[model samples]
Target: MSGLGFETRQVHAGAIVDAEAGARVTPIYQSAGYVFDSFDDGVERFAGRSARRAYSRNDNPTNVVAARRIADLEGGVDGVLVASGQAAIAMALSALAQAGDHILTTDRLYEGTREMIRGALRRQGLEFEALPIDADEDAWVAAVRPSTRAIYAESIANPLGEVVDLALLGRVSARTGVPLVVDNTVATPYLCRPVEHGAAVVIHSTSKWLGGHGSVIGGAIVDGGGFDWTAAAARFPHLHEPRPHGAPSFAERFGAAAYSAYLRSVVVLEHGPTVPPSSTFLLLHGIETLSLRMERHVANAVAVADALQDHPAVARVHYPGRADGQAERVARLLPDGAGSIVSIDLAGGRDAARTFLDGLRLVSQMTHIGDVRTLAIHTGSTIHGKLDDAERAGLGITEGLVRISVGIELVDDIVADLEQALDAVLAAGERTATRRSAAAQLEAVHP
Candidate 1:
């Protein structure tokens, strides 16, 4: 399995062959707790001195399988499953930083992630500063303070398909001694493995593409297992500090997987944002065909983007792989494709977005992305609605921008729906202009 292809590994990695019942598929271990061999065994498990799991909250066989499977796909050492993508972000950050610590991040990210950073995490007393996506390595290094614990960014941003320079950020992480955390929900492990680019931690909202059927909600955090926690002792005292009696510190005990070990044993254990084994069961199934599904997703996206460009109402198409200066970055980072999000800025503004959304027949207008079905949303009004007009403008959230999560449907059908919607936007704009012209004439006659 170590040298297997991604397609093969997605199906086989972290899978358990039940020797007891000879089950082929991983069965759901639905019990609240695992029975121990004896009282001493329970103590061992509780004390983290045994290999057997004592409780289902932190360690369930089914959940472990999903976590390991995602970690394997991302080329990481260890992983943990959580209730949602937000939990993955929160848990990973909580493990790395505490109150009064600072975090550096790229300006472009999912609105949901941004909200968490601005709203909940900020309320917790952790400080955050966003750098421009195009910030150089030196700029990132300069931003790091003694309290800076992490450099966070999304692999491919939401609504607007901005692709961050992950390799550059990875280099920044190395130079600054801060771990790089990446949210790879949009790209998934099939499209991009952040660890290979130098990310110390990889995050995912498995509810999206990983659970391709849109039936389950889950998240995962993967440790790259490369950062030298011992070397960064001054910055990360917890990883280096020894335990109460004679116990070794996380870095001494887990070595490469120290961060993940601490996250699972402490942060996640205390917070208890555990995902159910049933969700993991569905997630595992979705991952089996991830490679296959992503290929079609990319293809449909490229086709849709091409179609949208020729429409009269489209002002711009925000696909990552376009010739828009980032062509090289997209080619280097995302050779397979620049993911399935193809956002179009309408020339007719917010009114046009409303009309276009109203005219959609095949594509579902909703909040979620990376689903098997094509999903569309006006981010300025939904995801970024909390932000005022100025804030939305700063993030390039135009009034008419509509994000399309291209699915594996027939290219023609998807294109047809989009084209018809665009045509309606143009027709609505024309009617409005005509009414305005008639009103102007009436005003002049009255004067």
Candidate 2:
């Protein structure tokens, strides 16, 4: 698998040839539990002493194939699949830090992830401190405390497409002795491998590009197997502590895959947020063509971004790899492409956004990204709607901002659809301006 190309690995890395039925394609092992050989076998399985699985709550053959495939792609020693992207993040963090622990993060992250940090995770007693993405290396090291468990950030942020400097964060992680946990969802392994850039654990919303189609919802947590648990043993007592059943600690037993083993056997098994094997079957099919779909996805994205840049209705385009402050980083980190999310800020604000959305014909108005179909959404009114004006503004979710998840459609067709929408927005804005001016003149004349 290590010597194999990504295209080959995506298809064959974790596939199992069915021994009983001789099935080639991985079958969905949809049963709730595996049949135990005997009472002793069941006991051993439950005790984590057997390679055989006891239940589908944490271990299913189909799901395991998908997990290992994803891990192989991300250059990780092990991987765990959960029900959703949110569940993946929750389980990954839970495995590292518990109540009263702290995690440091780069400020620019997906809104959903940020929400979890500030909301649910905070309420659960885990504290997160965010540093500016551009903060100096010393600043990052200084931010880490004795209780700091991890450094988290997205390889490329959502909607805005802001690329984080992973090397800097990785260096900071090395200095602070905290593992770097990166959400590589937006910049799927097809575009960037964060583990190569010093990430200790990589996270992904396989519901996105990895699953390619918007069919199944799943998430994966991958352990890079690079972080030293023994050196940082004092901070992570659970990994260093012996099991309740008098078994060796996770670090002692699992070696390089200690975090992955802990996450799967401890957090995921206890929480029961297992992704259905049926969904994993669909996910496996999606992953088979990830590289192909991503190539078209990125090509269409760059085309759309280029087309929208000087459009009269667009105030700014949020695509990366352009002539901007992030150009250098984008070139270095995302040389393949800046991903498919191309967000635009409309000059006409909220009303124009409405007209634009209403006028769309080809692109679907929806709340998803990395779909085969191009999807569009107004960020301020949807994903960030719960926050006030100040909060939205702080996160760069403007009144008229539209997030476009560029699909694998023909570049010309995608641009044509977007152009029509922008034109409608501009026309609507002009009409409103004319009406306001006419009313003002009428009032002045009457006075």
**What is each predicted model's overall lDDT from 0 to 1?**
0.91, 0.92
On the 0 to 100 scale, the lDDT of residue 94 in model 1 is 96
Worst 10 residues of 1 by lDDT: 240-249
Q: Which regions of candidate 1 are displaced past 4 Å?
A: none
Model 1, span 97-167: residue lDDT tens: 99999999999988888888989999999999999999988999999999999999999988788899999
lDDT of 2 by residue, 171-216 (tens): 9888878999999999999899999988989999989999989998
The residue pairs found clashing in candidate 2 are none
Question: Candidate 1: TM-score?
Answer: 0.98
TM-score of each: 0.98, 0.98
